[model samples]
Target: MKATTVLAVVCVAACLSIHASALSPFGVGRSQLHKKRWWSSVDVNDLHKYHLDDDPQGYFGYLTQPMDHFDPLINKHFNQRYWVVDKYWKSKSHPVFLYEGEEAELELGEVAYGHHAEMAQAHGALILGLEHRFYGNSTTKEGLLLSELQYLSSQQQLADLAVFRVFAEKKLGMSGTNTWIVIGGSYAGALSAWFRLKYPHLVYGSVASSAPVRAQANFEGYNEVVAASFADPIVFGSEKCVASIRQGFSKIEQMKQAGQLAQIVKDFNTCQDMTDPNDFKTFASDLQGTFMSAAQYNYIEGNSSSIGTLCQQMMVPDPYQALVKMFNPGSTCSDVSFKDFLKLLTDVTFDPGAMSRQWFYQTCTQFGYYQTCDKNTTCMFLPEVDLDYYFAWCKGGYNIPSSDVLEQVNFTNAYYGADNPRGTRVIFVDGTIDPWHALSVLKDLPEGLKSVFMKGTSHCADMAPNDPDAPPALKAGRLEIEKIVSGWLMQAEMEKKHK
Candidate 1:
C-alpha cells in the first residue's frame, strides 16, 4: 500500500464579511473562518445561479445516518445531505470520486465545479459530495446541545462514510465493482487520507489537499510559516517586508502597555475601547488573522488580497497604520471584545446553518489547532494572544478544561499517526506557503509514498479549477495528481481482472 504526497499551491477567492464587533476573536463568524474555501457571498438558497444548466444532472438528496455510529442503543438518526453528479459516468463499473465535506454546509457549487468535478469528467466517473455530520442539514433533531454534539467526532464521521459506501454500493448498482476515490481539502482532506488508512477495502485511493494531519494544542508553526512567507521571493516578499511587520506589531504592543488605549482604538477604528487585557488580546488576534488570511490565500485566483499586495502595504513609511488599514478597511470599527466572543461561542442554541460553535467544539474535543503566537518568537502577532487566550474560549464555551483539550489532541495524533499516517494509495498534497502544510506529511515515506511540494503557491491552490494564469509548479502538481489517480484506477482494474 504505497502512497504519494503532493505539495501544491491553491487559492480561494471567497469574499470576507468581517465586522469589528463580531463575537469571534477572528473578527468574523467562526463558521466562515474555518472552511478551506469561504462562500460568504454565496447564499445557500440561491446556489442555482452557479449551476451550469437549469436542472443539471447533479441533484441534491439526503441519507438517513445514525447520530451515534458506535452506539447501537442510541437508535437515533439524522438526514445527512449530499449532492450527486453522474452526468459523466461511463457506467456503474467506472470510478467514483467522493468529495468529503468540511466544517461548513455542503454547497452544490462544490460538486458542480472545481478540480474534483473536472477529474470526474475526465475519468468518466461518478461524483458525490457528502456533508459532514452536524453541518448543514445533517444534524440530529436535538441540535447542537453539548450532549448531542458528543456524537460529532472524526471517528463518527468516518463511520458515516463507511455506511454511505455500503448504501451507495447497493442503490447505485455498483456493489464491489466501481472503485471509490475520496477527495477533500483542509480538515476534510485529513479525513480522506484517514479513510483510506482505516478502510482501505472501501476506498481505493484518496486525494488529501492542504490537509493538516497532525493535531497540536499550540500551533506555533502556523505563524512561523506566515513570517517565512512574508520573505518569499515568489510573492515579491522581502526581508524588509518581514522586518516592517515585526516592527509594526512591536509598536502596537508598546502602545497597549503605555496606556495609549484610546489612541490605539481610534487609530484602528475599533468598535469598543480596549479596557481589559482580554480586549487587547482580541484586538491583536484580529490583526494576526488578517495577515494569516492574506498569506494563506496569496496569489490565489479570485482572492481579495495577496502577499504581494500585503507586502506593499506593510512596506509603507507608517507600517503600524498600514497594518491597521489593511485589517479595518473603509475605517470600519473592529470588534475587540473577548467577553462578547465567549458569549457567542458558549451559546449552545443551534442554528441549523451555523458553523462557528460546532467548529469550536471540535477544536476543543478532537483537534486542537489553536494558532497561538506566544510559542514562536518570530511570530508577527503579539504574545498577549497566547495559548491561554484560546483555552478560555474552550473552557467558557463548552466547560472543557485545557488539560482535557491537550489530552484529546494527543489522542488524535496518536490514533492517526499524525504526519506519519499509515495509509497506502493516498496522495497528500500541500502548498509550501500554506500554514496547514506544517502539520501535513511533507516528506516522502518509504512505502512507495510520493510528496509533491509546490513552491510559491497558496492553500489548496491545486484544488481550484484549471487556471491559465496559475503558477507553473501548481500546474505540474495537478498533472502529477491526474497521473497518479490514473495509475491507481488502472491498477485496480488489473487487480479486478486477475481476481
Candidate 2:
C-alpha cells in the first residue's frame, strides 16, 4: 500500500480499537448529572459536568484531538469529553446534550453555549451533546463511512440523539426522564424537529432556528437560492427574474450541446480579468456532484477576494482534479468517457422546474409525484443528469446532496407530506437577503412553528447582538429564543403526556 493508504489504515484501526463500552446502546444515562438549583444568572462556561458511571469521582477530562488518516493540509480532527460532579444533591432531571449539524462534533454546541446550557442548568437540567455519529473524533471504519454512515429518510439524524440520551442516562450518570432540548441552525434546525418526533419522551421540545425538515424536496432549488442570494448584485446590476441567471445558464447549455462546453469553460477560466467569471465558470464546469458547484460559485461570487481560489478550483489549475482523485483514487481523468462525463454534468444541474417534473414522473412515489413515465403522457423533463441521487453515497460527495439542499425542495414536496399531523414544529430562519432561504421548500411545518428572518446577512446567524460586534436586535433575539424554546418544549411534553 502507498504511505497514505497505510497511514489511513492505522488510523482506522486506532479508532476502532478505542475503548467504548455499550453501557447504554444509545448513550443513555443511569442517573442525573446535576442537583436541582434555581439561580438568577447562570454561567455557561463555568458549567462542566457529565454522568459517565465508571469514573467514581465524576471528573471527565476532555480535549480535541486529531483522528485517523487525515491529510494535515485539508482535514482537522479533535475530540471533546466532559467530566461531571458526583450525584450528591442532584435533581431528578437528567441532562441531554444536543449536537450541532453537518460534519461537526459535539463541541460546536459549546460555541453557542452563551445562555442555552446555562438556562437548562438553572432549571436543574443536565445538558449533554448529541455527537455526530461518524464525524469529527467520532469514527466508524476508516472515515470512509464519514460521508454516508447514516441519516434519516427525512434526513433527520434523531436516532443519534436517542442513542446519546441513552448513553448519558446510563453510562454518564444522568437520571429521571431524558428531558433534553434540541437546538441548532440550518441543518441542525431540521435535526431539532426530528429529535422531538422520534423520541417525544426523551426530548422535551426543539429550538430549531432554520430547520429544513421536508427531506429530498427541491435539492436544486436551495442551491439556486443560496447562489443568487450571495452573488454580487453589483455584478448582475439588477434583479431580473430567475431568468437573469437562466440567461447566463442558457449560453452554457447551448455550448454544451455544440460540444464546446469544455472550451467555453477553458475560455472563461483562462481570461485574465474576467468580470463575474466565477459565476460563469460555475455554470460551465462539469462538476460531478450537485450543490457543490453552486456552493463554490456562491462563495466566489460573494467574496470577491476568493475569486482566485474559485478560479483555481473550477478551471485555472483545476482543483477538482485532486478531488476526482479522492473520489476514484488512482483513476486517470480520461478514464471517464464522454457519455459518463455528460451524465455527471447533467445530473449536477440545479434547474428547479426540471426537477419538479422528474419527481412527479421519473422517481419513486415519495414526494407526491407518483405517475410513471411511459408512452404518450410520460412526464416531460429537460434531459439532464440526476446528480441528486447519483453521487449521493460516493466519497467526498456529502455536500453533493447536502441535507439542506435535499430536504428543502423536491424532497419536502415528495416525502414530507405538508399537512401530516406529526406535530412537527419547524423554524425556517434566513436572512432576508440570504438567497438559499428564499428557495427553501420546507413546507408542512406545524402552525405553531416560527420562522425568523435575519435581515441583511448570509449563512452566519448564530452569534447575534452580543458579538461585541453584533447589532442590538440580534442580542435581544439571542436571549429571547430561550423563552420561545421553553414554551415549545412544555407544549410538546403536555401533548405526549395527555395523548
- Which candidate achieves the best lDDT against the true structure? 1
Estimate, for each residue in 210-234, the C-alpha lDDT of model 2 and write its tens digit: 3444433333443344344434342
Candidate lDDT scores, in order, read: 0.74, 0.35
Where does candidate 2 stray beyond 4 Å? 1-97, 104-125, 142-157, 172-178, 227-262, 268-421, 424-428, 433-447, 463-465, 471-480, 486-499
Each prediction's TM-score versus the true structure: 0.90, 0.49
Candidate 2: TM-score? 0.49
Kindly report which residue stretches of model 1 are placed more than 4 angstroms away from their true locations once superposed: 1-28, 31-33, 36-56, 300-305, 330-332
**Which digits, one per residue and each the tens of the lDDT, describe model 1 over residues 202-312?**
999999887888888888887789899988877778899899998898898888788887988888888778888777777777677667766666654443237777788
lDDT of 1 at 323: 77
Give candidate 2's error at residue 341 in angstroms: 11
